[model samples]
Target: MAPLIAVAHGSRDPRSARVVTAAVAAIRARRPDLDVRVCFLDLNAPSVDQVIDAVATEGHSTAVVVPLLLGSAFHARVDLPGVLAAARARHPQLAIVQSNVLGHDHRLVDAVRDRIVAIGVAADDTRTGVVLAAVGSSDLRANDRTRALAAVLAGDTRWAETTVCFVTSTEPNVGQAISLLRSRGVERIVIAPWFLAPGRLTDRLEAAALQAAPDVVFSETIGAHPLVADVALDRYDTAVVAAARTRLSA
Candidate 1:
């Protein structure tokens, strides 16, 4: 089997890289026969280019590149592809196949709920209010998809209310979202991060939420959840098939 390079949007926080590294490790555990590796886009070690070069150097003729991103934003659409194109130019013998991103997979929603549950926030608790927090983007539509997740969680239970707020680059920030939940008489609020890993943005969200309402608590981030690893592996499997077809046609 060709190597599976799981690429993450790197962060200066070592925790972010650790989470990704561990998650890819889990993928390896699940499929010991598969060659799974982790790399970063920036601010972390073993960057995408480095990994691609290593894969080519390792004598792999073709490899699958699975994006460990939650949103199909600029990094997914532009940055990664640009790097892959360069890698192809540098190694004409190696075929690099980029897989689909780990976008709002419904299983990920389950992972968020799992995090909330881990924090002792019952899914059916009516007094509880949930703020689905994410690192917002400048693209409004990207923000909208994240914002819409609030309802998907609310619909799952009788929680007082569910609302979304951005940690940056958008309206209804952490404080505003808490106030909106407060207006609805939700005294117990929990900020459930929709992120795969915690970083500076998550710290900012926590500080702001506490400032708005000190009583509010936060669930753990969606890091290394078995479901996330499952989704990534699924994306890799899909890309493998797609890549094979492309090669046959070419």
Candidate 2:
């Protein structure tokens, strides 16, 4: 069986790391025979290089890299590719497959929507507002993907207003987003974080939203949700299928 590496945007928060660790464990439970390891792109231990070396050392000639990121942003495009390139050079005989970034999949969207409902926001009531808060990205494309996801939830919940806000690099940071919703006559505001971890930024986002509107509700960060685990496994499966096709054509 091929080795699998789960890569995440590491966090200083131990809870964040545990979430990813648990998610990988769930994946392993489903496929007990496969070799699986978890690592981070940066800001934590077991870096991408470490994971690659470990896989090669274990006699695995081919490995799949599954990024646990929510959107295809800088890390997914540049950082992840650079890590794979370095690993490729170090282990020339090893075959490495980089899978797609986890972004806006139906399963993930459903998870967020479920969280919103759990926050006491009536699904049928059209008077409430929802703000899909995320750690912003400089990549416009990535930000757009998050906005599209918000639209999906908006369509399903039929909230009075659905806006996408960021912790950085975009307009209407959480506070302003809440104000916008209020201006539009929304009765209640729900801030749903699109982050996979509870880090400093996530704390700041919640604080700001609370400061702006004390009545606003902030949902839990999206980490290790069963749906998210499913999405990660789906990404790995896609890479496996792609690797098989490449070998067939070769």
The CA lDDT at 18 in model 1 is 88
Clashes of each: 0, 0
Model 1 score (lDDT): 0.90
Candidate 2: which pairs clash? Answer: none
TM-score of each: 0.97, 0.94
Identify the runs in model 2 with alpha carbons over 4 angstroms from their true place: none
Q: Which lDDT tens digits does candidate 2 get at residues 100-198?
A: 988778787788888888778778878889999988888787777777877787765677988899999587698889988888899988898887778
Best by TM-score: 1
- C-alpha lDDT score of every prediction, in listed order: 0.90, 0.85
Clashing pairs in 1: none
Lowest summed lDDT across 10 adjacent residues in model 1 is found at: 147-156
